[model samples]
Target: MEQLNLLFEGFQHALTPMNLLWVLLGAILGTAVGVLPGLGSSMAVALLLPITFSLDPTAAFIMFAGVYYGGLFGDSTSGILLNTPGNSSAIASTFEGHRMARNGLAAKALATAAMGAFIGGLLATTVVVFFAPTLVKLATAFGPAEYFALAVFAFLAISSVVSESIVKGLMSLGVGLALAMVGVDGPSGTVRYTLDIPQLFDGMSIVVITVGLLALGEVLHIASRIHRDPAAERVKPNGRPRLRKHDIKKAWPAWLRGTAFGLPFGIIPAGGSEVPTFLAYGTEKRLAKRRGDIEFGQIGSIRGVAAPEAAANATAGTAMGALLALGLPTSATAAIMLAAFQQYGMQPGPLLFERSGDMVWALLASLFIGLVILLILNMQFAVLWAKLLMVPRHYLYAGITVFSVLGVYAISSSTLDLWVLLGIALIGFVMRRYDLPLAPVLIAVILGPLAETELRRALTVSEGDVTTLVSSPTTIILYGILLAALLFSGAKHLHRRARQRTGDSEGDKELIDA
Candidate 1:
C-alpha cells in the first residue's frame, strides 16, 4: 500500500509537461541512434552525459530512461531491415528477423520485435517496481568479497559463453584489463601504462574507447571489404504492420520464455543482454524442433524474432533495476549511468531509496511512461526507420566516421584522444577480423578496477588470508556458478570439435578409397 501511494505520487511528478518533453526528446534521439548501425544506447548515453550536466537530476534521468527504452525498440528495426545490428544485443534478432526481411515479411518481423520488446520490458519493469526493496535488501548483504566474486563470475561467463573459442574470449578480456590499467592506480597514485604521457594519467576515455571499438572500428572494417562484399538489398516494409495469427500464436510463449532467461541475469554480473538474448535464441531453436511447426535457422521464424528481442529488452529493464537497487552495473550502458549518478554526488544502493526517495520513485514512474511512449512510436514508425537503408553505403559510412570523430573530440577537445581513438579503432578492426568478441573487452574495462579494488579491500579486511575471500556463503555460491559455467562451456566446445573431426575423418576415408 505504501509503495503504491508513493508510486502514484511519482506519476504526478513524472507527468509534468517539462519532464514529458525531455522524455520525448530522448526517445526521438535514441531511436535515431538505434536506426544507425554501430551506434548503441551505451555510446549514445555516454556522449550525451556531458551535455546533461546543467540539467536537473530528475529531468536528466527521465530523458535517459526514455533513450534506453527507445534504443531497444529501434535496434530491432535496423536488424530486420538491413541485416545489420545496431549493437551486440540485437545480433540474435538479426538471425531470423533479417531472414524474414529477405523473404519480404519485413513488416511482420518488425511488429513481432516491437511487441516482444514491449511485453518483456513492461513485465520486467513491473517486477522492478514491486521487488526493488527486496532486491535492495539482498544487495545490502553483499560485502567486498562478495562483489569480487560476482565480478569474477561475470568475467568467466562472458569470456566462456560469448565467443566460439574460450581462448579468444580470454584474450579479449586481457585486452580490456590492459586498457583499464592505463590510468593512475587508485590505491597508489602511480600510473602503470601511461608511458609518462599527461593524458594517460586521467586514463583512456570510455567515450573514446567505445566509439573507437564499435563505431570507428565498424566503419574501417566495412571500408576494407566494401568492394568484396555484395551490396545489401534494401528491404522495404510490406503489408499492414501486424503479425499474422500464426506468428502471433508462435511469439507469445517465446517472449515469456525469453523474459525468464533474461530477468535473473540482470541481478547477477552477467555482461548484459547479449548473453540472455543468445540463450533465448538457442532455447527457441531447440523448442521449435519438438513443435515442428515453427521453423528455425535457415528459414525465417517469428519465434526467432520474438524471443531474443524480448530477452534483450527484458535484460535492459532488469539491468536498470539492479543498478538502482544494488549500485551494480552489469552492462556498458549501466556503467555510464552509474558514472552519471556519481557525477551528481549520488550513490545507488539500499540507502538510495531512503535518501533520494522522490527521485527514485519518479524515475521508476518515468520508465513506465517511456515504455508506453516508445511502444507506440515503434509500432507506428518501424517502417520509417527502415528507410535509413535508402542512403548510399559510402555516404552512410562516411557520416558515421565523421560522427565518431566529432563525439570523441567533443569530450575534451584533445588531439591526443583522437589518436587514442584511431589506435583503438585499429585494434577493434583486427579483433573483428579474427572473430574475437568485443563485449568482453568492454566488460573487462568497466569491471576491472572495481574487481581489483574489492579484492584489495577483502584482503585487507581478512589480514591477508586468501581463505577469507570464500568465507561467505555468497562468495562460495558465486564461485561455484563460475566453475559450472566453465565446465559447461568447455564440454560444449569439445563436443563440437569431436563432431567436426568425425566428419573430416569419414570424408578423408571416402576420398582415399575412391
Candidate 2:
C-alpha cells in the first residue's frame, strides 16, 4: 500500500505535460538510433549526454531512462528484418526472428517482439516498485568490506564467466582498469598515470572515453566492413499483425516462462540479459511439442521468438532497479546510464533515495510510459524500420563515424581526447575481431575505483584483517554465489563437450560399419 502511494506520487511528477513530451522525444530518438546499424543505446546515451547539461537533473534522467528502454525495444526490429542485431542483447532474437521473416511472417515477428517487450517491462517495473526500497535498505547496511567483496564478485562474474575465454576476458578487464587509473589517485592525492599533461591531470572523462570507444570505435569498425555484400532481403509486412488465437495460445506460456527465467538474474550482477535469454530459448526448445505442428528450428517456433524477447526486456527492467538501488550496472546500456547520473551530480545508491526521491520516482514512472510508446511504435512502424536496411552500408557507417567523432569533440574540445578516442577504437576493434566481450571491460572500468576505495577503507577499519571482509552475511552469501557460478559454468561446458565427443564417436563407428 505504501509502495503504491509512492508510485502515485512519482506519477504525479512524471505525468506533467513537459515531462511527457520529453519521454516521447527520447523514445522516438532512441528507436531511430536502434534501427541504425552500429548505433546502440550506449552510444546514443553517450552522444546525448552533453546536450543534457543544460536541462534540469530530473528531466535529463527521465529522458535518458526513456532512451535506454526504447533502444532495447527497437533493436529487435532491426534484428528480425535485416539479420543485423542493433545491440548484443538482440542477437538471440535474430536466430528465430529472421527465420520467421524469411517465411513471410515478418509482421508476426514484429508483433511478438513488441508485445513481449511490453509484458516484460510492465511486470518488471511492478517488481521494482515493490522491491526497490527493500533492496536499498539492505544495501545501506553494507560496510566497506562488504562493498569491496561485492565489487570483486561483479568483476569476476562479468569478465570471466560471461566471456568465452577467461584469458581474453581478463585482458579486457586489465585494459579498463588501466584506463580507470589514468585519473589522479583519490586516496594518495597524487597523479599515477597522467604523464603531466593538463587534460591527463583531470583524467579521462567517462563521457569522452565512452563516446570515443563505443560510438566512434563502433563506427570505425563498421566502416572497415562496408565493402562486404549485405545479406538478407528487406522484408515488408504483408498485413496487420493481429495475433491469431493459436498464436496467442502459444506465445503467452512462453512469455510467462521467459519472465520467470529473467526476473531472478536481473538482481544478480551477471553481465546482462544474454544468459537468461539463452536459457529461456533453450528451455522452450526442449519442452516444445515433439511430433507436431512445428519443430524448434523449422517454421519458426513462436516460443523461440517470444521467450527470448520477454527475457531480454525483463532483464533490462530488473537491471535498472539494481542500478538505481545498488549502484551496479549489469549491461553496457546500464553503464552509460550510470555515467549520465554522474554527469547530473547524482550518485545512485541508498543515499539517492533519501536525497533525490522525486527524480528516482519520476524516472521509474517514465519507464512505464516509454513501454507503452514503444509497443505502439513498434507494432505500427515496424515495416518502416525494416526499410532502413536498404541504406547503403558505406554511407551508414560513414555517417556514424562522423557523428561519433563530432559528439566526442563536442563534449570536450580537446585534441588529447581525440587521441584517446583513436587508441580505444583500435582496442575495441581488436576485441571485436577476437570475439571478446566488451561489456565486462565497461563494467570493470565503472567499478574499479569503487572497489579500490572500499578495499582500502575496509583494511583501514579492520587493521588489515582480510577475514573481516566476509563478516557480513550478505557479503559471505555473495561470495558463495560467485563461487557457485564459476563451478556451474565450468561443469556445464565440460559436460556439453563430453556429450559432443560421444555423439561424434558413435557417428564415426556407424560410418565405418556402412
TM-score for all models, in order of appearance: 0.76, 0.63
In model 2, pairs of residues that clash are none
After aligning candidate 2 to the native by TM-score, how far in Å is the CA of 502 from where it should be? 8.4
Per-residue alpha-carbon lDDT of candidate 2 for residues 289-384, written as tens digits (9 for 90 to 100): 333546456657777889888998898888889898888887788888888888778888778888999889889988998898778877888666
Q: What TM-score should be assigned to candidate 2?
A: 0.63
Poorest stretch of ten by lDDT in candidate 2 = 229-238
Cα lDDT, model 1, residue 321: 93
lDDT of each: 0.79, 0.73
lDDT of 2: 0.73
- Runs in model 2 deviating more than 4 A are 1-121, 128-133, 202-367, 492-514
Worst 10 residues of 1 by lDDT: 230-239
Backbone clash total for model 2 is 0
Model 1 C-alpha lDDT versus the unseen true structure: 0.79
